[model samples]
Target chain A: MTAESNITWKANFPDSFLWAEWEDEEASVFFHRGSGETLLLNPLGAYLLKTICSEDISEEKLAQRTVRYFDLPVDEELLSAISVSLHTFEQKGLLLSSASQ
Target chain B: MKPLDLKPGEIARLLRSNGLRLQIGPFAVSLRSRLRRVAEQIAFFYGDYPRIEADAFVDFHIQINNPAGLRHWVRPQAIFSFDGFKPFKPLPEDQAFAMFEWGLNWCIATTSHQFLITHAAVVAKNGQAIIFPGEPGAGKSTLCAALVSRGWQLLSDEMALIDPGDLSITPVPRPIGLKNESIAIMKNYGDETLVGPPVTDTIKGTVAHMRPPADSIVHADRDTRPGYIIFPTYSAAADSQLDKVEKTRALVRIAEQSFNYHILGREGFRTVERLVSRCPAFDLRYSQLDSAIAEIDALL
Candidate 1:
């Protein structure tokens, strides 16, 4: 595990996020009022942001939650994908992270 | 009273004097032009539109006239001014009428903040509207014209003014602007007499305006709820196809096509969300107008 993986992250503007999802589709659209950015998210990206919006979580925990949520087997590939998504969300200013104590 | 009620000399006199005030959709526009072609085309294309009284409030005061000094005689240029400020550079005098149509589009897109505006063509049937949002040369105007010729009501051929409050599309029926071969295609498909003379050598290249159906202008006050959002692409090699589009993808595509999406901010996002949520979207690719029209007719 890398040091970046230990950081805890939460949605940057939890209250400012407006989301719309359809029952039959895996993709969803969200608008971030703070940044005034609208984004379309695939199923995994949508699930990750939604999970993080509820509470702060470490990358390891997030990967585990994602695995359990999607009913996928535990694997390093899943963990690496989750790490990349976390950093991508951080780069987009959609997620904020802090050092875990 | 409609513009058709006035004689040719009277239309010219009104335009040269205090300006011809006409109620276009929801706004009252006062147009003053010394150019004879502008006055004539206004009467030809907008004959069914209601004329506002001289004393009534006017939303836009527009003037199209020759530029001052030697440029007016040398190159023969026409300048478009909103109020007193000229917003665009002068074009050739032959393009004076096209300039008026484009200038009015600019005036409405910039000033109308109450509605979420998209650079799309809107057409209606059975109280439901289908919005075709695409960039220029995407054949939106061609498709819109073809549909209107087949008994569909033409809401607008340029922009879709969507009410944010209820997501209803406000009708702003205007002459359909056709370019290149689309102009010739529509001429043969519909009433050739309804089309204005083709003006060539402008920025858009060989453009003409098709008068909206008389019934469309008469029913301009009626707004329709959004029924479908379709992105159309005209390809000579492709067969007519209307494929389903996911709602989230549709929302993003529509936001990209909107003229005032960023201006309306959160309200714009919410309004578009409501629109996509309610209306099913499709990606339509077709070369044949009849087949395309048939596919669309099957939608509603």
Candidate 2:
């Protein structure tokens, strides 16, 4: 997908998902449950999912925010990863696309 | 009045005729068994358990005896009945007492929903409770037996009953099931008076039950908030070690090991989340009983 394509992907998370989390120096664990599925997420994945649930944000904005806040390398690969993660979340019914909502 | 207050002959007569009503933990149990060995064991082992009044509400009506058949003479077998329905196939006649214990556990696990029950051994010290959740061979019962003898109160040796209303653990103190080498270990490590006769060959190898301390039964209704969630692993080559378990991991493990977690669904998830958040979790491994006790004592 083009860099501009990432800017159109606004998503939301359902309220029915129950969650519990724990974090250490290396990674954070997220136990997310809803619709008969329980998913375990790493720190980056958990952050991305929680961000979507907490706000109505696009994939490009989330990636930019993540890179700025966590001081990660900003590159094409990182942007592609963010787009793929948001899509994965939508496929799992964890993220509700603005069009779908 | 305690069961001991009744003469053994009277207890036997009631078992053979009407039934003996017992106040075990929060449940009213009516047990009827004609086997003489059951009566003798009840007199010796259950003497400390107080008798529930005849008019009280009975939660489970149980009976253990040899069924009428030609096999009654050829190869006698004892059947355990709950509410007039037999849930299990008849075991050897000699396993009547053990059957009673197993059946009682089945009754509670299947019926109780007000409390979140887990397959764990719970013991308390200094007003704090430690819940030991483990599989069948995890040495939980052996650890429970040893802890209760060293001045800790035995809440229960098989089940940890957590009242959902307040999240406090209610004591259901009963006998600690010791199996195989652990039975011998408990006898050698602690006072012999704490244990009962070994019942062999029924299911989980050679099994013996250790009677709970009298003080534990006397304070059966008192509830304590959980302070620690410990998963014990017994290994002969391992040195005593207590490793910290992360909260999320601890919650998942407890839910996986619970008797009614799935049945309770979202409520079960919330209860375990609250419990794990409030209590520190650990994995303890030990080979020696004394050292294991010492490490746990240090926790309090």
Candidate 3:
């Protein structure tokens, strides 16, 4: 996965999330009462939540960075699989993609 | 530790499990964590035995039996213990460890104090505990998390330990758990120091625990007299207020809600009688945290 797509999904989460932590088998979740949304996440999704919590990044860069962190055998298929996870996060309202990306 | 032989004299015993050695004091307990985290909120809140002095001890002895059963014992000044036959199958993980903790608290609190433990959020100020008891989704925890942040000593977020002898509240201060929305909303109001990760999909939307302030934990051993009993109900976006409840009516309401009132029978009735006579009861419905805090603080 390219770094851009990886963390870019974090943009959807609001800054007011009170508690965001890995729930393990359930992955990580971010709770925001303002939005009244609690998003469940997977391992990569949780990583994305932490990355976004730390700072903002673009989609392509997020995808790339995520691939690097996993130490997977480098390839486009690996990148595409990771992007699918990002899409699931977006569907869950956990990530917001910038139109520019 | 030997598999706790649930015999008569074994109400309280110390042993080793999972590398942690726990000293089970009369009402309190002390444990050393075998894992990396200092002491999980559970240990600190429930293990308030006199051994809190911090002596080097073995890792927290852990026996999966009764999972959260360790929390049921009362603290140093009192002795209350029970041994339930382990269920052939562990309680399904869907129920929280907190529930078991509260259940165990119910058993011991009822046995020793002959008091009913209620599902509620309780707070104390000036030696009086104001109980906000209700069912889940009644906004008890949300209101409680807010009140403690505004200076109320958190007596408990889940268990209201009422003494049948005097109708007073025995403080069992512990971390408050907030499900999904409440977790975020509490932070929006400016409390950001919540501990523990959020658990998802078990029952509550998402859940997390906020540590009771240091002072609450330090004074976890102290008891607060019952002052006012308020049964709180929270709304999504509605006018908030507290109104006085009649004595006879409030008595019935409490008996219905108390965890141990039935355990002690007549004694429970008289104890609650003493409480209503000495304390005022109210029905509070609130949607705003600030207004709720202001209303309660002003009453204190």
Candidate 4:
């Protein structure tokens, strides 16, 4: 999946959803009640989603923060996974571009 | 006074005239019906519920009347009215008891938003309520009836009421609705006197309602903290097992089973989140009632 060009991804209308997050043995779990969707995310994805929800942040900045938050070496595979998950969230209507906000 | 306090003839007259006012947990209901059988069943089944005064406030005003037409003469039919509005088309007259039970469920599920309502059967033991959320034919009511027979207090047999403020479960104990094989199964296991005769060929395929225990109805104001959420699925081919459900999946499933989860929005989210965080959830499958009862009893 690919995010649209020329727009920054964020949870522009987070209040329209009812959400909760908690840690499980397997992974961090997030539930969006308005979409009836449950997403299992690794630490990196969880931080990205949580940041986007609470702050006005761009997807590029979110990617940079994930690496710093995890204290990991910058890797292409990690960035690619975050990009795909962000695109999925956009398709699910959980996130929208800043231009549409 | 209880409905059973009046004689059968007197109950019929009261229902026909001023209607029967009764306190059903958090709601006061006034039921009016001209049909004698409706009066008899209500007196027989709801005998333990406290009667309400004539001047008391009523949450729902419901009536079942024989429709005024030739169909009432030819085959006989009943129409269910709620607060002066008929929400359903007429049904077979003999299905009046089933109609009343389903109609009242609809009223509560539709109107009561202060509490999050789930389509689940709930019972409490040692002051901890366990919710069994299931679809039709999932044997939820059967499991609930078995638990209630084993001295567990029935909170509800169809809807689990969760207060949005504290995430506690309030008791709205009503009759346990059993269908098809469950009717005979409950009758064989518990007192036959507690189970009404099966109403044949309704939309749910031969439905019967078992009277809730007297204590459950008497102490209907009691609410319990939620302890567990179990999804019970009955299959003759599968062995009895209780598998732990991950908290995240459990949260989504409960919201899916709830009638007002989406309507309540943020409050609904926080309620389920708090509930799932505190309680352990499981996926329970059973072929026999005895094993199921034993396993569930061990959960407490």
Candidate 4 residue B225 C-alpha distance from true site, Å: 2.2
For residues B82-169, could you state the per-residue lDDT of candidate 4 as single tens digits? 9999999989988998899999999999999999999999999888999999998999999999889889999999999999888889
Can you write out model 1's per-residue Cα lDDT over B1-300, one digit (the tens) per residue? 554578778889989999989989988999999999998998898778899988999999999999998987787989999999899999999999999999999999999989999999999999999999999999999999999999999999999999999998899999999999999999999888888999999899999999999899889988889999999999998999999998899999899888888888899898998999999999999999999999999998
Stretches > 4 Å off in candidate 2: A1-13, A22-40, A44-101, B1-4
Leading candidate by lDDT: 1
Candidate DockQ scores, in order: 0.74, 0.26, 0.01, 0.32
Winner by DockQ: 1
* Model 2 agreement with the true structure over B51-157: per-residue lDDT tens digits: 98888899999999998788688878999999999999998887888889999999999999888999999999888999999999999999999998888999999
Worst 10 residues of 4 chain B by lDDT: B1-10
Q: Number of clashing residue pairs in every model?
A: 0, 0, 32, 0
| Model 3 Cα lDDT, one tens digit per residue, A1-101 | 34443344445545655433322224443444334444444567667666766777776766656777876675778667666766765665656767425
**Residues A1-99 of candidate 4: C-alpha lDDT, one tens digit per residue:** 122334587784676544456654545656665675656666666777778888766666777777788887767787788778877787887887676
Winner on DockQ (2 vs 3) = 2
Candidate numbers sorted by lDDT from highest down: 1, 4, 2, 3
Weakest ten-residue segment in model 2 chain B by summed lDDT: B1-10
Weakest 10 consecutive residues of candidate 1 chain B by summed lDDT? B1-10
lDDT tens readout by residue for model 2, A1-101:
23443344433334655677654533333433454344556567777877777777766677777888779888888777777777787787777666555
The interface RMSD for candidate 1 is: 0.8
